[model samples]
Structures are given as C-alpha cells and as structure tokens.
Target chain A: MTKALWRRPEGMSVVFILLSGLILVFIFAPLLKTVTSSGPGTLWGTLLEQDVYTSILLTIYAAFIATLVGLFLGVPLAYILARRSFWGKGFLEGLIDIPIVIPHSAAGIALLFVFGQQFLFGRIFHGLGVDFVNTVAGVVIAMMFVSLPFLIDSAKDGFRGVDVRLEKVARTLGASAWQSFLRVSLPLAWRNIFSGSVMMWARGMSEFGAVLILAYHVPFMGHYPVADSILVADRFASFGLDSARPVTVLVILISLITFITLRTIACRGVRT
Target chain B: MIKIRALKVNLGDFWLEDINLDIEEGEYFIILGPTGAGKTVLLEALAGLYPISQGEIWSDGREISHLYPEKRGMGIVYQDQALFPHLSVKDNIAFGLKFMSYPREKVRERVDDMVGLLKISHLVERNPSTLSGGERQKVALARALATDPRVLLLDEPLSALDPETKEGLQGELRELHHRVKVTVIHVTHDFEEAVALGNRVAVLNEGQIVQVGTPDEVLRRPKSEFVAHFALSRNILSGRAGDGEDGYTMVDVGGIEIRAITELRDEVHLSLRPEDILISRQPLHSSARNSLSGVVADIIPRGAVIYVTVSLPLELTCLITRQSLEDLELRRGMKVWVTFKAGAVHVF
Candidate 1:
C-alpha cells in the first residue's frame, strides 16, 4: 500500500488521498462502532428470540412483495420512457421519482389519504375486507410507495442502453414485437432489472417512517404481529440501547447475507 | 421484384419524401449515399419497419406497405452487427427459428448448417460479447439468413470492419449471394462497395433518389451533381464540343482539348475517373488519343494509393500506385505526361 501510494504523483496525491480517506472513515467508522458495541451473546439471543426473527422476516418478506409489485408495473413504464417520445413524457418520468424526493412521512400521509378507511378508495378496499390500516398490506403499500423509484430509474437506464436497431433486426427476422422484447430486450436488461429490484428491496426493508404511519403492527397472515423497525425503536426508548442494538445487528447481518447472495446471482450473464 | 412508389417517411428531423425504387428479383441492388442520406431509412421502410406516410410498396407483385415487419418476410443486418449479447452464437442464429416453431431437430440442423457455413461452429457455445467484431458480424448475418426471408436488407454492414476483414467478408458475401440467390438491397456510403457488389445502384441524397442505374453508369455517367460528388468524380468540366478527325469528337475544356470516341452536340459535360489517367515521364505512341503535359502540383498519399494532382492548362487528378510514385520519382513541381484513351472520357 505504501509503495502504491508513493507511485502516485506526490503533489495531487496528498489532497486526493486525504479527501478520499475522510469519506471512507466517515462511512466505515459508524458501522464499525455499531458492530463492535453489540456482543456475540446478544446477537445470538436476538436471533433466537421469536419476535425478533419474525419481525425481521416480516420486513424482508414485505419488501420482497413490494419489489415484485414494482417489477410488474414499473418495467413497462421504464421501457416506454426509454424508447418513446411523446408530449409530457419528461413530466411523467419526473412524476415517477416524486416518491423519492418527498419525505417518507409525507408519502405515508398521501398514501393514507388514498388508502385511509374514510376515503373513497380506502372504503372500497375496506368493503372488500382488505384493510390497509395497521396491516401487512399497508406495510407493502408503504414500501412500494417510497422505494419504487430505484427500480424504475435503473430499469429505464437499462432499456435505454439497448440499441433500438436490435429490435428492428429481430422484427426483420420474423420475430414479433413481443417476441423480440422477451428474447432480446428483457434478457439483455435482466441484470439491470435485477440490480434495481435489489436496490428497491433494500430500500423497502429500511423504511421506517412510512411503514410506521401506515402499519406499525403488522397482523401478518392473520397470525402473530410482526413489527421490526418500530419494535427496535420502542425497545431503544423503553429498554435502552442494549435491547435494541442486538436487533439492529441482526437486521444488518441478514440484509448483508441476502443482498450479497442476490448480487452474486444478478452478476451472472451480465454483459462485459 | 420489389417496387417502392412515392414512399415518404417522416422520422422527426430527418425525413424522406417521394422516394421511388425498383429492386429486381435475385439481384444484388445497392443504395449508395453519404452519411445521413436516409439510406437506412429507405431500407427500413422496405422491410416494413417504418410506416410510409404516403404511397405504397409492392414486393413480388403484392402490396405490403402496411404489414408488420415480422410479416413482411425480410431480413436486415445493421452496421454495428446487433447480435444478442445474452445468447451464445448458436442461440443467436437459432433465435428467428424459434418463433417459427420448428421442431427441435430441424432447428438444430438449420443452426448447425448456418454455423458451418459461416465457419463459426467453434464459437457456437461462446457468448457474443466474447467474439471479435468480424465474428460477431458473421453471426449476425447467419442469424438474419436463418429465417430465409425473401429480401435481405444490409445497412452499411461492412463499414465498421477493418480493410482486411471487410475484403474477406465482401468475397464471402459475393459467394453467398451466388449460391443462395437471395434478393439483396445493400445500403452503403462507400462508392467502391457499391461498384463492387451492385448490379444496379441507387444514389440517395438528402432523402431523395437522385439517380439510379448500373454501377458503370452511376460511376462513369452520373446524371446529377450530387452523384458526381458522391461518386468522388474529381474531374467534372464543361466544354464546347467540336468535330475531330477520324470520326472523333474533341471537347475544349478551359483551353485544354480532350478527345473522346463519341459524337456530341455543341456543348458537353465530361467526367474522367482519376484512376484511369496514366502518368508517365514522356508521351508514348499508344492508342490513347488524349495526352497532356502538366506540372505535378500536389501529391497526397491515401493508404496504398497516392493521388497526384497535375496542373495542366487545366487541372486534372491522377491516382497512381505508391510503387509507381517512387519508380517514376514524381514530386511536386515536376512535369509529367498524363495519357488516357478517348473511350475513357465520359461525355454527357
């Protein structure tokens, strides 16, 4: 490391190295401190606790479902945004990103207006015996609301990178428009979509303010309640740092394992 | 045979208006033009990839103007060789066949045949990203040809390749065209490629079909100034035609009289190919009726060939081999004799 640093130009390297080191320390120091503060016994105990594991699983599962919903709705919009030109297209694209720019609590309030029990849509869904208030469905809706932009933007970039001529070539070769998209464009854009899904999923997992307003207690699958982030916050407030730190470490560990595995799978067949 | 009558397309800023063409069956037709001349646009229109704003297209005596590209029964190869990056070479070739719902065995047979024909059997299992440019081009061609479409449209397919790979593919294309007998409409900005591969060539300039004729006619007898410029006809001089001895016509071009073996009216336009002019130290007693002594004003080396511009009473450009440039010891300001046969002078 010393030899590599010495090989860099001395004058510019000093400032460059100093600034990069600052950023590196800024990000890593907090994470290192958090990991070291939690004891192994506490981590093991949190893992074995039924509520802790259930809440963590509920967060990931809700986020996964939200990502799946995003894939279904966002990919078509992404493709259209990438390939077509029309009036208000730029405005429409910007609209998709509004969830990201706005505060999550504000997003929850907006969603509550639409999904709240007294409102028209809320009453309609409530009549169907599917209530969003304090339910897993509400949790998914909140996650989807706040984390959808990552999937749509990444997918749009992926679709834009594909040459339109490739589709034309496919059409000329007796492949229909649908076939071309399935066999050529989708496979070509899969890596990006996968990465985008992972990002959306991670963002959804970390969501607190929106999920808190939307669904603090998830009556998940008509069974035991699961509330990961809110439970951690409650524990920190009432039972102090030791009680919450173990759950925080557990969430980080599970997220890292899941994120790394999905990333490895997503990396396959990616264009060089 | 394919006939395009008054076809017009509006693709945002660049548009083609009233474009007409007739590509005969089993003929290697070439669309010659410069970049942004709407050559690819015309080809795409023929393939039904783009909607024509007006007029119609009839292929094999049937109107297919509004058909979808997949139903048009045409294959196209783009300049960048857009092979599917996610698929192996064999899978890329087999892609079109999949939509046809052919049996597994038949698809394998056809894929193997194309792989064998293109000499890419070794690369069948390799992804397109791992292949070289020429390899990818061959795979793209194989994929397009696998469907056995009625007409093959090539959009500057050879422009991206190096000289050696291009030359090799050009020969392979010629051989494939002969053996397969598929109707081809190749679009290119390179005049030499058109001259080499085209039975009939169309010159497109700014979305209009300026001229369409055989390669010899397009090269030697361009009908418009655009064609003259696009064909790189350096010598386009207007002259007064006068009667010459022994049933020959003489044109006085800026006080320099050039002889041609043709009858002409009072005035004429002449085009002389630069490569046809022979440069020598002295005028020889040859059958060439025209000979002029001029001082070499400029010598520019373009790859293997050198363009020697001579300032006669009228300026003339002569293309000569690099070895000849050295053998004759030609340089700027040296006087040299340029000779050409009377038949070589194209009088219009």
Candidate 2:
C-alpha cells in the first residue's frame, strides 16, 4: 500500500524511499553506537592525538594542492567541451570520465604501473632524482586523478548552461571571442566552478588507495617533513607508513571540516 | 547605389534560387515575401553573414560578397531588436563606429549626430531592456546609421511591435530614411508597410522576385497572380475581348461588358484598385464609361476601412469608409450601382 501511494502514474518509485531510509540509517547508526558507549572521551582523545593532528594537516595540504591542480588543467578543457564541436568529442569526454568509473584501488594500481620503476615516466623522473615510490607526489597525483573528472565535468556543464545567443550578440557588438567568454560565459558559470572546487578538494581528501600505492613516503606529518628513501622493499613499507601514520590522522581530521563545506556547496548547487 | 544580380544560394531547405534587384542612392526599396521565403537569408547574404553560393553584390560600385560583415560597410537591424544587453544605448550606438577603426573623436561625433537625429539622446545611458518598443526601434535605427552605412538592411524591424507602435515607428523610420538619404532595403510581409515605406517595391515569392517597380505599377498591373494577391489588390476580372472600335476595347466580364481605355491583344484581364471604384444606387450618365449593376454580397470591416464586395455578373470589390455603409444604407444583398472611370480600368 505504501509503495502504491508513492508510485503514482509516472511517479517517483519506492527506491527513492528506500534510499533516503538507508541514508538515515548510515547517519544515525554511528551516533547511536557512540552514545551507548557511555563516554565521549574516546572520541575526544582520538581527536587530540599528535598522529591524528598530523594526518588532518596533511590531508588539507594535499587536498589543497589537488584542488589547485584541478583548476589549472580542468577549466580550459571544460570550456572546450562546452563550446566547440570537433571530431572525437564524445570519445574525449568519455576519456575524461574514465577515472570516475574505474575502482579506486584499480586506479591506484594503474598509477603505480605507469609511474613505478622500470616504466617510462618512472625511469625518466628517477633520472632527474625524483622518486615516485613512497612519496607525497604520488599522493597528490592520485588525488588529482580521482578528483579531476568532477571539476572538469562540473565546469563543462556550467559553461554549457550559458546561452550561445548572448555570446553571438556580444561578438556582433565588437567583442572578440575571448572577451565574450570572459564577460558573458565566465561570470555566469562562476558558481558551478566554485562548487567544483569544493568537490575537488573533498575528493582529494578521501583519496587513499592511489596515494598508498604511489607516493606514501613523504612522512605525512604536521610540522616535521620526513623524506625517507630507504631501498629495502620490506623496510620500505614499514618505515614510510610509520612516518605517514600521524599525517594520515591529520588528514582524517581536516577532511571532516572540508566534507561539511563540500556538502553545503553541493546542496546549494543542486538547489539553485 | 546597391545592386544584386542573379544571387543564388542554397541555404538548407530554404534556398534562394535567383534574386536580382538594384536600389538607386537615397531610394527606399522594400523586399516583401511571406515567412520562411528566405527574406532574412537574403538580407544576411547582403550583410556578409552568409557565404554566397553564386552571385555578385555591388555597393557603392565595389563588389563585397567575399568581405566579412564588419568589412562589408553595411548595417542591419533584425525583427527581434538585437541590442547588446550589456551595453548602454550610447555604447550600442557607438558599437559600429568602434569597429571599422574609427577614431575616438569621430566615434563620439558620429554617435552624437545619430543619437540626435534619431532623437534618442535621452535614452543614451539607459539599458535596452528598460526602453519601450518604440524607443528600442529608434535606438536600433540610431546604431545602424551611426557609422553611415552605404546600404541599411532593415529585416522586418516592426514585426514584433503592436499595431499602433508599428505604425508610429515606421513613420519615424521613414522620416529618418529621408533625412539621412541612406539607401535603405527594408523587408516586410505587410503589403501596406511595403507601400508606405517603399519608393520601389519588389514582391518575392519562394525566393524569386516576381515583380519589381514603383508601388503604383506593381499595384496597377501585377505581373502574376501571386503578386496581385500579395498586394491585397481587389481587381481581377477574367473576360474575352470582343470586336470593338480599333482603340476602344470591349470585354465581356461574366456577361457584363467592361469598356477599357487601352487596347487588348488577347483575352482581357482588368486590374483595378478597390479604392478607385465609386458605388451608387443610380447609374449616372457621365464621361465614366464602366458602370455595372450589382448587389452588395459581403461587407468585411477591416481596420478603418470596409471591404464591400458587390456581386455583379463579375465580382467588383470597393473600398468605402465605415460611415458610408450606414449613410448609404448598404447591407448584404442590397442592389447597388458600381461606377468606375475607364482610365482606372487596368489592362495587362
């Protein structure tokens, strides 16, 4: 009977009801468990630890880098996607969206293969004294790869939402193509770009698998920047992870703040 | 001077097959066709907006088909007043001059002159959206004329406005054309608009110029049935010319004799304006030779004029004032005498 009520002719189905219900479950179930523990100390102590602080800081730093990277590479490409039509446009769009569809661990493995020892980029970079294995560069690359699609897709949709007629009129009025974009299309799509920034930052913060695979040895820390490049394969994992533990904790803490900001921006983007 | 010869362009489904026309300096010519007859495409082609498939267009004795719109030295105003929404009225007027590499002093001078001539100086700083329909029309005119175009192409600029506004705006545009003495090629489907604004009218049907002449020539003697209908012409009588005195022609129009002043070589076709016919109850004996007895069959009240159709053996259309219908006690099926001069009887 409830299903029937929700399912009117050409109506929203019971799946929406179940989806909202599941969200309510995920949000409340955790708080309910914490409440039953009879202590807020566990949560508070976990929050104040040095490793936690360091991880949170590293997350913010790396996410900030990822967001900035997304901006530089994503914006012009997005404008191209929105504005012009050329051969292989659909194929190019699908290529941009590949990172989003692939599993995160698979994405990590893929990055590792490309930037690892004995690979093209890996050998070239190693020749320049740049090591990708167990480093912060890998973390940022992973974050950027996973989060770039969001920024590009959002920015492209933003530019597409603007009317082409307005631009044409501007062109007739003696404004060049670049001038028209800056004056007409850019201001209109700014809100979408802003939302894309938040999404990019949040996506960067949550990127774990790719970071773990490629550059996990920057000693993810709050103040002390550790650069351990020991060449033993087993010692490699044990030493670098110890240094990155505090940084990981800091990442988790900072991610909470960014997640809230991203949620607010995304909700507003959808609403308006 | 503006000249277009055998302009052939295949713009998708609405191809302009062969359009040929010319306008003398300071002449007002209107190209008229129904909607989707490629009127806009023709105008844009002249303005260098579209590539000409096969044609030669000359403006001021220079061929400009290959030039860009900005380099073509022509200005255009569309039906939907495409004022740059971002700019003020002053800036909009200054737009054309800014391009074409005008100096700052000349741009300002030209803008001022045009704004004053169009009498839109008060609206200079205001946005286009804030202006009324008539005001925007004036601004569009000002902007188009600012750079002093060799040929001004107005594409149904009055189509979207209300009747009163359209009439007033066209009057203003007509006055502007005269004052500026610019070669204007205006396009509209409105017959009266063509007549009111055109010194020479070209009636286009399906992208072909069926007739091009003075309004009187086109109206008095239409080249074809389409041109006749397009002008809302009321005179069409199918009859066979019979043997008469050498110069004086006699034709039988549905058993009624019509005496025409001109000689007829073949079957007689009479083309007369409805306004030329004078209706009466009694047949008057005068120099006017053609007088036919008929009954008023239909009375259609158009705006400020009445289309009174008299059912003689041949249908005769007469234009009379609304007051005449009541004053003459005219009604459907009322017997009436339709008298018109032989000179007014057109032969083609």
The DockQ of each candidate is 0.72, 0.19
TM-score of each: 0.90, 0.73
Estimate every model's Cα lDDT from 0 to 1.
0.88, 0.77
In candidate 1 the C-alpha lDDT for residue B328 amounts to 99
Residues B1-348 of candidate 2: C-alpha lDDT, one tens digit per residue: 888988998877767977888889999999988888888888888877667899899988999787766667677777777776667899888876765688899888988998889888788999998999888888888887877778888989999899999998888988888788888899899988988889999888887888899987887778776777777777787777766564667877777888877666567577778998988878877778788899998999998989899988568899999888778988788899998877787776
True contacts kept of 1: 0.93
* lDDT tens readout by residue for model 2, A64-140: 88889789888999999998889999999999999988888788889888888789988988898866676666677
Interface RMSD of 2: 3.7
lDDT tens digits by residue: candidate 1, B1-348: 999898899976877988888888999999998888888888988898877799899999999998999998899999989898767888889989988989999999999988888888899999888988789889998998999889989999999999999999999999889988999999999999999899999998888889999999998888866688788889887899999888889888988999986667677888888988999989877999999999999999999999999999688899999999999999889989999988888887
Q: What are the candidates' interface root-mean-square deviations?
A: 0.8, 3.7
User: Model 1 Cα displacement at A121 (Å)?
Assistant: 3.0
Q: Show the lowest summed lDDT stretch of 10 residues, model 2 chain B.
A: B240-249
The collision pairs in model 1 are: none
